[model samples]
Target: MAKKPEPQLPLGSSSTLRGLTESFSFHSSPESFITSRILAFHKEHPDIVDTRAVVRAKVLNRNVAIVSSHAQIQQVLANDAAGYEAGGAYDELMAPFFPSPNLLLTDGGKHEAMRRTWEERMGSLKENVIPLVHQQTTEHFSEPSTSEIDLYDSMKTLSWKILLGTFLGLEHRDKLFETTEGLQENLLRGQFSLFPVTVNTGFWHSPRKKGKEAKRKLQAQTLAHFKEKESACPFATTDDGALEDIANHSVLFTSSLAVKALASILTALVLNLYLYSKEDGRSLAESLASESDPGRRSQRLRSILLETERLSPPIVGVMRRSTRENIIPSTGEQADVKIPKGWDCWLYFVGGGRDPAAFGSTWDAFDPERYINASIPQGAAFGSGPKACLGRELIREIALAMAETCIGLGIRMQGNIAARGVRGWLGWEPNDAVKPADWAQDMKQLPTQRPSEPVMVRVARS
Candidate 1:
């Protein structure tokens, strides 16, 4: 059988009508925009590496560019001074939660200082973090359950505990968990509200107002908690000002952003392993557990983790704005596209990871073997360049340890999995009762991308 040639769209073209439709689609049906609209566009016109669209709304009308190719994504992310600056979108969306400058908001020297400090602290704690993750995973599934459990919720709780213990030096029995979780929920609701801008008025009950209040309470709680355990913090500094900086930024890590992302990735990982095992007619868990060679086991585990992440990235894309007029340099087949100053560019990770040119013809397949001896390209997962995720390495270690523990305990999906959006699974089954309309209502893309519906599972000790 021969492959059909992909249709090519003219380079550097803008569509007014299509852009308006897309803008409306993004505002009304954001959850499906990527899976249905953007992915569908890529499939239809594979040769279009970059396209310009105007995002029009009541409050704002901005020129938006969507960059999907691996090469183009790498170039944009790597060159920060080429008129592109980070944190424009983040500053707008995450202002309520992270009011102060943190790792996500800072750039250049300030970012380097904070990232280096946190990296050193995390590296020192890596040895202890692995055992803690394993211990938490084991204890989570140790108790017997008469009914199926929500794997997503379980993972979220586990991640929350580990992060609190690791960053804030809080024990499992700490009373702040309940209070913090509530405040975190409130903040997320406010941040991701339907209308981008929220009016803070006393006339009506507003989620944004509630969210701001929650931020204040959570900030106070975090500061007080840190004051009591300041000496025990892994990243604690002798300087009071530096310590306060650490405490302020700690809110971002402990908030729903970090916790939900870790939990979502872990959930997707477990689901992928189970689905792949069934397809191969072999127990991936057994193979991983039976492997006696430590090096081989670790390598295989890392490959599997990478493959899972490539297919179902927790953060689908990152946003950046052009500070000055610039041109995205042509790379191979991709042509140079002009990005005017103030135009927002979205580097789509999902599209880049699944690019057949980069990952082979079977890019969409769940094949971990492809990564066994392969060099992963930049922007494939955690992203590339200076603004890439700092906690990616630590996240991988924690997820792998938790995954290993789950496999050792013989965990498996019990009931039909309900998902808000498709996660690149070829033949996995979803709950039949959920209508197509219901999925749109449940899908969420901000903060983290994961199934909003419960993913039921059963754990049996082997």
Candidate 2:
């Protein structure tokens, strides 16, 4: 028998296929443009909760309709999510940058199991590692602030050190300090992906993939180091005593991916360090600066990050797909939007972070003070609900540390930096498929913690 003809997709679906194109600009690709566009659109068209636009594409996919309502976004992240498989699409799009496979790539049992492992390691880190956070930050901040310095690069150095120390628990963890330093240098250039589909597709995009490979090699040695210690005794075996949870070998392997995830965390703190140092942010920073209190600093930093996340979310939005088919629970009169299967769900973290319905009047300004006073839940920064950012503790700790260090040491920005947002692609993940020379020139600041470009800053004792 002859094969039956397959049903055709809508012509508009094919020829009219346009991804969220605005997210990726050719000539001038500043995140501010993308953020303002989507946010402005949402602000004007209140009724249309989910506006269809060409934000960016993932591999073969395009024309993603970005949604800002928290509820709409949440529906996509739900494990019982019915309409689509966001992680799958994300994996397809970003796998080249993060091929090692970790918590963010998949959903269901395996995702949960790995996530639990990661959570345990992180939760267990609070006591043992938090003190180090204080110690290092305090020491770094103790010095007098004189010359200007790239605040984010400085923080990235600290964040990288802290993460390697706490998570990897490397012996003399600072040894590998520089290893994670410039991780974001060539990484953000991947932003051109949404537009430069040709180059990014071939061997041109391989730094992140190479990083993953390096991590895999390191994992073996790392695991050997840990196993020997475990065979001798458990890491939590000390007295008076802080509990030291050894990052599992499995985590060691998964770290190949985790470090890439960390680019967002690193980038966020770096952005905020300079942003909060600005005139607009100084008010909130001033409030915390005078306190000399960790709790107060935490509160202030939370506000700053929320505002930053609202205005310049590093990961602007998370891509999610429904795991189970079901109606989303809602408060309004109408029922939840019917989510069909296999749809790409884009959560407007940037949208909800700045939602007028959620934030009310002062939604537009860069007001960190709102987080301290307003009722808007500061949940979107690391996400909320069941799948909240598991790395939230680290995000908070690192951000707080960067802020406190600035306050105590009086670290000033030697030069101006933009706390701008991200467009087509996240800036942290590298395109491993591409050769280093093919990418932009690697700029240096710190011999170890160099960023993509030389973000010039001069520094001295405060």
Best by TM-score, which number? 1
What are the per-residue Cα lDDT tens digits for candidate 2 across 95-198? 44433455556565666676786676566656666666666666655666566655445654555555566655542245443443333333333321344342
Score every model by TM-score: 0.84, 0.65
Worst 10 residues of 2 by lDDT: 419-428
Question: How far does residue 445 in candidate 2 sit from its true spot (Å)?
Answer: 21
- Segments of candidate 2 deviating more than 4 angstroms: 1-59, 78-87, 93-101, 113-117, 138-147, 171-212, 228-286, 292-298, 322-339, 410-462
Candidate 1 lDDT over residue span 1-462, tens digit each: 344333232233255546656656554434345445444456676775323221122212456666666766777788654467776756677766665777787766777787887777667768878888888888877887778777778888898888877777766776777777778888888876655556756677578777778888877777778778665466746777776777777777787778888987887777766645635466566677778998988788888888878766777678778887767665445445677777787777766676666776566666766568767652256878877888888899899988887877876545444443443332133323333344356544555766656767765665
Identify the leading candidate in terms of lDDT.
1
lDDT of each model, Cα atoms only? 0.67, 0.47
lDDT of candidate 1 at residue 316, scale 0 to 100? 67
Q: What does candidate 2 score on TM?
A: 0.65
The TM-score between candidate 1 and the true structure equals 0.84
